[model samples]
Target chain A: MTTTTIQQDLYPTRTGEVPGPAIEREHPTVWGSEADGPFDAAALEAHEQRGFTILENFITPSEVDLYSAELRRLSADQSLAGDPRVITEKSTGAVRSVFEVTALSEAIDALSRDPRVLDRARQLLGSDVYLHQTRVNYMPGFKGSGFYWHSDFETWHAEDGMPAPRAVSCSIALTPNYPYNGGLMVMPGSHRTYAPGVGETPADNHSSSLKEQTVGVPSQEAVTEMAHRYGIDQFTGPAGSALWFDSNIMHGSGNNITPFPRSNVFMVFNSVENTLEDPYAAPTPRPEHIASRDFTPLR
Target chain B: MTTTTIQQDLYPTRTGEVPGPAIEREHPTVWGSEADGPFDAAALEAHEQRGFTILENFITPSEVDLYSAELRRLSADQSLAGDPRVITEKSTGAVRSVFEVTALSEAIDALSRDPRVLDRARQLLGSDVYLHQTRVNYMPGFKGSGFYWHSDFETWHAEDGMPAPRAVSCSIALTPNYPYNGGLMVMPGSHRTYAPGVGETPADNHSSSLKEQTVGVPSQEAVTEMAHRYGIDQFTGPAGSALWFDSNIMHGSGNNITPFPRSNVFMVFNSVENTLEDPYAAPTPRPEHIASRDFTPLR
Candidate 1:
């Protein structure tokens, strides 16, 4: 299932134009051992029911170290000045996120296009998937703020014209996640219900550091009720563990004001057949790095 | 038992010098109805056993409204520049704390020295009590960060030279405490066991906003073990409900990024007999507002 052909020129094109169809495959290719890669029928069934699945040892320890080192270097780079793709914390100028990682680092790009990852995406999504976004979130020590409780599809549906939640995000941990360090907390079976959140859009949705904080997060009443019905679970493990979640799952993380750092590489894959159209009257306000206009399906 | 002689000059004196003997009282004066105050033999027993007690309807609705209005005015005043008592959030510049509220606002001062409040303090402390600190915490919407899991006695013992944990804080809620709005969470029976935390002291111990975050908070393993043993409890109720907690109780608050504002008035009373002696060789690092050198007992 591994292919050498890469679609580097497909990005930065005009808005509303879909890139060409990806190289087709006969069947989903399985990779890794049974312990790590649960890319099987049972795994797909669980994802369909629960809206999330964890893949242990998705990458080797050495691979995680390499990715972490590359991320440190990319964050320290001053070349991408004033670029929306690179965002920092409000008070301390620590880099909070580096979007579109595929366009920058070769190692991260190669990892994103690994045959095993694409094969799993193909199996669950049940169609050819394209790289929607590649983000590296750096939850640095003692200063990292938190994302409020929200579902990804709510923002995508309200702001970007994502027709349906035919997408999934693979969050690859670059550091060991502990309870005190503020790892991701998700409510089980929340994806089964769609909560059109009650709020207006924030002024700038593209920025990693959300200053306005007007995004449609779950209401306190809703979170309390949902939490009561389906208890919350925290995602905590060693580095290289991968969490694949549905776009509509209710999730949030606490502020990381501890010594331990929490960093993750998030790659969002959208089914090529469910490509987005802008909901706004004007041009898509978000930059290419955040909400990509390029719908180039991957091989 | 109400004496009006306030000791405003006792502060700014040398750290080791006890100001003077307090106005002595023969027996503890009881106040409030049997249902609310519980200032009896059983009440002291409960305080000794549980380390915290909540006095429902501690203040009338009008009193809460008056204090809340004065607090709003104090927070809006721009003329208090260079005043170490007024501290703001490091990132947003929103007012996080206004220390020594008794010295700044008469309404808050009267509330702090109210007969009912003093009577209750006398019953549990078993001696004449002095005002250690008076602070109004303003957790405005969308910007309030959190205080990590820690005991107040740990900081007061290490930095402020508070000998034994013979102090209590009466937190009067200025706004209705809801769960999502970052109400305080305390571990029941935690005051019985002191957790020797692991960390260096923060540079600025006076500021409410923890920019340095070097204060010794409970470790992850300790919190986990204790949480399993005695589950955490959140304090939630009407605006006027007062929570009286021991200084050694393990407690912390969540971030208040929600729309609901969480404002509270915390009045810490130290036993006159257990007055501080400087732990450090140099003079007290913190200002008088945060840690008073005054030993004059309250009437």
Candidate 2:
């Protein structure tokens, strides 16, 4: 029998809302209820069972604008994607500027403490919570680049007793997700099974590069909404809309099928069980250093 | 209240009968479960919440041969720790040789599928799990370097869903962890609190060096098992013995006080939820090129 497909729309009127059923699916076991007080059960249960779940409207409209401006500035100086490696530079083009803008922005810090957002994370993460690491995926046509599908843990090298990641905060949508425009796509349940490394050497690429990650077979039916029509979950909407979900989710972003750039700021807040390995890499409080303003609420 | 410290011998005597709580305090959360079939719960859970747990007979008796040999070879090398960054080279005496040894041995490969060990991991990581990275912390006293309390995630540079570290795996007892020999130590619940960064520049010699990660605290009593009498714990143990726990937990090793070199294989692993942002940098597995017969697993 063919497996049923599901999609979810985090924000209505937004560009890419995952189709129905994709948000939640049946599973053999129940998980993540241990720290249930602060999270949306539906979203997390979906994550525990489905490997991933999306919560749209995680970011406010105002925050979206703030991210958009910073993204525009970061990408403004970018020249021709520059081979997918995230580079911190001092050039003067859309792409280069975008990177610079991101590096200099406080947006990441704000999201780290966005009470509205962290409250849910706190529930999922248990009482004590700390910022892990943050990066802005400013996907612009002229400035930003597209990504490949892979798990995040594939890159980490472990020390003893350290906490492995379970949940994540992925905020996106400067432009709504679109099929051709490079919206996000994921492989359902790929989180559990792991393939040995292909013995490929790591490229010098920073966080943004995806081609180097191990690629897996994504579900054909699971990629669509009703009737397998919508493979790409359009995340378009007013700026500042972010989606939060577990990192194990098999998701990928489509190449910006639209003309303009697709921008989003992803900030991950882990449970107190997981702490920042380094102090310098702690999470910032906002999507960008918007007007040098502090958007972090009292945590 | 000062937590009571458990000082049970990490080693099982020849007469030490089957499973018991004696090993629980230092074992990874995985060992002994019903799904894996059969568990010594009474003997297992008897320890203090298992701040650290060890997997008994994790490495085959024969595999222990490799550790003994390698430790012997390094102990003789005297200046093997020549470069601070070199830490200790793979079997070939080259830092880059680790890649060459991935497929080299049967015993090492078996270590990957060792049902006895992976079974425990499955219990901790659910049905799905992926080996995150593998590394060997081979150090002789000549280098005289010691690590301070910190998480392993610092190297990821914080992208992907790869939050700081979740759990750590280290097999102790090249000869058995002891205060005199510089064993590994932990501050137990220290992971429950947040340790802020000192705000050092990345380029600062003090900022990025492992030798510089020192954090000053009043006492070692607050630490779990890693803490010894004087704000320290080497957590050392015999070969073939391993310890796994949360990364944020306060832990570190002391200088090798023993005349013999200290060598232990600390392979880091992660679940799908943890490896999203960075996928390439995981540590090296047993080098495939080297014969398992050539290397030894620590006591």
Candidate 3:
């Protein structure tokens, strides 16, 4: 596509007078061409129809242990105290998420570049892929907070300058994600619809939003309609399992008040063909660590 | 200036055949037009002639204690462990420098926006200013590492796409800077001459360079010539003192093997008119925390 075409097709959000949430159905769920490689016809059909797919034992238990240890080590790192990449819980001051996992850890970086993950991402995006964002979401037992319902693409399009919903996110569980411990919930087939959110993006919104996102969230009515129309599916599985979802998918999780803690190594892959332009909504692009401007494809 | 003129006037470094070290003397040391503002005639004249000026008691002792406490608290923050903004010493693993200090601490943020500092920065750049970079450099006793001789503009121009050397750095002494401990050393009158270093910038150079900068450093011959021609001056002072210097001035420090620790809060202010564009040398701009892309004026 020409640069002008790409700029014009920037999945509109936070625009126009009194912009409010609406279900847009123009964008494609998957952009990749080579569907035969990696994912079989059944899995591809499931993903296309459901907006997400789950793979059991995507990594071995031993690998999960290693990554879990890395998560713990990173969480305890005192040097990260004031760093913006490390977002803390609003109420508990515990680490909510740590962005830029690949750059932070060599092992995780290797995983991001691994063909098992990279090839599938390329096949899904139909182009060379770069990490749009990566993080480790940590939810402690009892006092762990939950994320509000939101579409990742709404924020990516408005605040991060992502031109289209041509991105995929992989969340690899490091700890067993039990239903009671706030496992991910998604509205099947919701990726087919784009829910544009209300309100102008505040400058440096990521500072507060990462801790507890308020903007770019679909209203309760829209969310309830989506749930009723498409039905809700929960991703609850053993450690080492993975969930792959479309960028525009409506997804969120509940508060984990159970004794079991939940943690996942999350990675987002964006098509290099769909690299960022100027933010469609915000005054400036979010920090590179959060919404990476680096379009260097994973080798 | 027009955009074309600004692009043409980019302080060239890491360009042309051989790109060897050379002293170019076309750019101005100070860009501000208002000479009758915060700085008196002698201070302005000293800054223009010597490339730097020191202000004693720029902040009070009680203020120093508060900032120092904040620094210690930030250094001990476990959440920052693997964050790219928090660079640790190569050998010791102690916190070397914490970038984006203003975003990290309310106190430091307030300090950066304070009129005492902000007004002088406006006077130096002769335009509205934004934070190009902010960090707290912590040099622990005995094992603290020293920076190599280089011009900050070299990296800022090549990697950050800064249009010119129309920027100023303020280093506020949070701890007493004794001669025995490692303190800042600058070559007087060197800001008038731009020293282009030899070498192509490695991709993601900040990852390693922050710990111990190897690239973009001037050769021994260049350092010797500059020191002999301009003479070297050390910034040794009691706590709460501040030193403002030109962006292109040659500067470095020695290893501190003494029992005393030296710490300083460093802030870089760039002219808003001279904001970043595409990088001149590197594959991508450095992370926002290190070389901020945010152009919002410090109001």
| DockQ for all candidate structures vs. native | 0.08, 0.01, 0.01
Candidate with top DockQ is 1
Candidate 1 lDDT, tens digit per residue, A1-299? 88798533211111222312222122222212233443766776677667788888999999999999988988988898677788787878788788899898999888877976877776667777888889888887655667777777666655666666778889999998865466787777777666555544455654632432344555566666666666666787899999988887878766764456789999998888778776431234466687777998887
**Interface Cα root-mean-square deviation for all models:** 6.5, 25.1, 26.2
Q: Classify candidate 1 by CAPRI docking class.
A: incorrect
- CAPRI-style grade of the A/B interface in model 2: incorrect
Model 3 local distance difference test score = 0.82
Best by the lDDT measure: 3
In model 2, how large is the Cα lDDT of residue B269? Answer: 46
Residue ranges of candidate 2 with Cα displaced over 4 Å = A1-38, A74-103, A142-145, A157-163, A200-239, A276-298, B1-299
Q: Which should have the higher DockQ, number 1 or number 2?
A: 1
RMSD of each: 12.1, 27.0, 24.0
User: Which ten contiguous residues of candidate 3 chain B have the minimum total lDDT?
Assistant: B2-11
- Over A1-299, each residue of candidate 3 has an lDDT whose tens digit, in order, gives 65554335536776643546565667676665445358876777788788898999999999898888888888899998888888888887888789998888898999998888998898888789999999998888655656666789989988988888889999999888754456787878989888777677888888888877777777656776776687666787999999999999988765543345799999999999989988888999999999999999889
Taking the tens digit of each residue's C-alpha lDDT, what string does model 2 give over B36-132?
4223554234222443565556565567777556444543454545533233333234331121212333444456556655555544533444554
Per-candidate TM-score, chain A: 0.84, 0.59, 0.94
